[model samples]
Target: MRAALFQMTSGVDPAVNAAAIVDAIGRAKAGGADMLFTPEMAGCLDRDRTRAAATLRSEADDPVLAAVRDAAAKAGLWVHIGSLPLKDERADGRWANRSFLIDDRGAIRARYDKIHLFDVDLASDESWRESSVYGPGEQVVAADTPWGRMGFSICYDMRFPDLYRALTNAGATILLAPAAFTVPTGQAHWHVLLRARAIEAGCFMIATAQVGLHEDGRTTYGHSLVVDPWGAVLLDMGDVGGLAFADLDMGQVADVRGRVPAITNRRDIPAQVTLA
Candidate 1:
């Protein structure tokens, strides 16, 4: 399968970010890509909650989602919109960090609200409390694609291996991890974690990321990568934001699993263990 990855430096404006994704859709189709993947927070990345809240809309009303779906249909390309911050209807009034899988016909195939939220205090003294604003997701989502069953995840979710194991156990051959990572963490752990997940699961790992400085006065570590089941880095768009393509061999998933068979060999861990 031919995949297009868009590494973007999304700003505070939804319209501007939508336009960039739309353009990438057209370009991906023109380049003969079957699917396009984008970074997390593709719609808007604003640090200030008050400012971001004004731009956040429901999935039904989000202009960015609308534009991407329309463009995907027009381009006849499958799109994995990394994640959009959308207003949630729950009583707590928190928003959701949601990812979408749009079919070639512009239909909503599946939606995955980010299960793990980034709540960290970095060594650089930068801190984020995602749970304060966004509620955690309850379900794990995977959807059928032309390539294979693709599992979904957002930024901080990459650090958790159990999520990927659950996905592979459910028959997912390709995993999507779109992120807007902080520079310090990204530099230290990004590639290592992604590669480890792919290796352990024996599945393809696609991570498209946010790059460069943004309108919100923050910088992101942007090395968008596509790793094969064998833990090979197929494509890495290093530190720059634009459209990049990679050709995936779906058959490799089976080949790698046949050799390693990690997923098939997996056994349930006992609930309690004695101290060594």
Candidate 2:
């Protein structure tokens, strides 16, 4: 199976963002991709989370989604339309960071809400308390796909390795981390963390990311990648806004499992603390 990872740069406009997504899908289809994955905050990446609330759309009336679903049908590919804004119950009209898996026939197979809220403080006086803007997901998701059971996660969730292990433990072979990682922390920890997840899970790790600047003047780390079960990078489109392509063999999963066997090597153990 072949997968396309879209490294996109999204701002505030829905129409413009959707058009860019259409173009990325075209490129991926032309490259013979069987599956395509876009990044987190897929439609619009705004600086003001409060203003972003006004743009959130329901699956029922989103024209952008309709067009993308149609494109998925036309290309006969499973499209992971990473994360979008779904209106929430908050009085301020917050949104849930959600992802949908649109099948080859244009059916919405599954939806995964981002479980981890990105509430962090960086050195730029740039701090995000995602909980103030969005609600956390109720559960971790591992969805059924044609290629394999694909585990779904958004940006900040990558910081937690146990979640990936749980997903892989539940029969997931393809792990997708759609991120709009910040330039600073991403430069320091992004690749190292992603590669570590693949090596630990013995699975195919696909990451579609946001590149360049956003409406809020925030730049993202956009080295989107596709790593194999053996921890080999199948393709890496470093800091580019385009499709990162790779042909994935389902058999290699078992091959890597046979070699490393980390899954079976897992053992329950007690925790230790270093603080004194």
Candidate 3:
């Protein structure tokens, strides 16, 4: 299956980002791609919680999502809208970092809200409290498509191995880790972590990322990647913001799993506490 990954530098305006997404979808369709993947916060990236809260809209009212779904239906493209910041009704005023999988007919096939909220202090000046504004999702979501079974995850979730394992156990053949990683962490751990996930899960890994400086005064590490089940990099879209393609071979999953049965070679050990 041919997949198109869109690396974007989204700004504070949802309309502008929507335009970019629409154009990328057109390009992907024209190139005969079966699917397109985008990055986290694809709707809008804001500098502060206040501005983000004021700018974001609910899923039902988001123009960006509506436009993308319409384009997907018209172009007969299966689109994975990486993640969108939307107002969450369950948490009163808190928002949701939601990912969507739209079918070729413009219907939403699956929705995965980001479970891991990024709340870290890289430095005094470069700290984020994502959990402060966005309520975390409690479920892991995977869905079936014509290509194969796909596992869904957003930025910080890439750091968690258990989630990937669970998805693999649930029959995921391909994993998507769409992100808007900070420059410091992305430079330090992005490639290593993603490659590790692919090797461990024995599944194709696709990561479409946000790049360059944004209106939010944040610089993202942009290196959208596609890795085979054997942990080989198929395509690495360097620090540019655009579309990159890779043809996925589902047969590679069985080939790698047969050689290294790591997923099934596990022994459960009871937890114990010992005095240090």
Backbone clashes per model, in order? 0, 0, 0
TM-score of model 2 vs. true structure: 0.93
**lDDT of all predictions, in order shown?**
0.95, 0.85, 0.93
TM-score-best of 1 and 2? 1
lDDT of 1 by residue, 208-271 (tens): 9999999999999999999999999999999999999999999999999999888888899999
Q: How much is the lDDT of residue 90 in candidate 2?
A: 34
Sort the candidates on TM-score, descending order. 1, 3, 2
What is the per-residue lDDT of model 3 for residues 1-276, given as tens digits with 9 covering 90 to 100? 999999999999999999999999999999989999999999998867778777788999999999999999999999999999998545557788899999999999999999999999896378889887889998999999998899999999999998998999899999999999998898899999999999999999999999999988889999999999989999999899999899998999999999999988966656886779
Model 2 spans > 4 angstroms off? 89-93, 270-276
Estimate the TM-score of every prediction: 0.99, 0.93, 0.96
Ranking by lDDT: 1, 3, 2
* Model 2 lDDT tens row, 192-233: 888999999999999888998777788999988888887888
Runs in model 1 with CA error above 4 Å? none
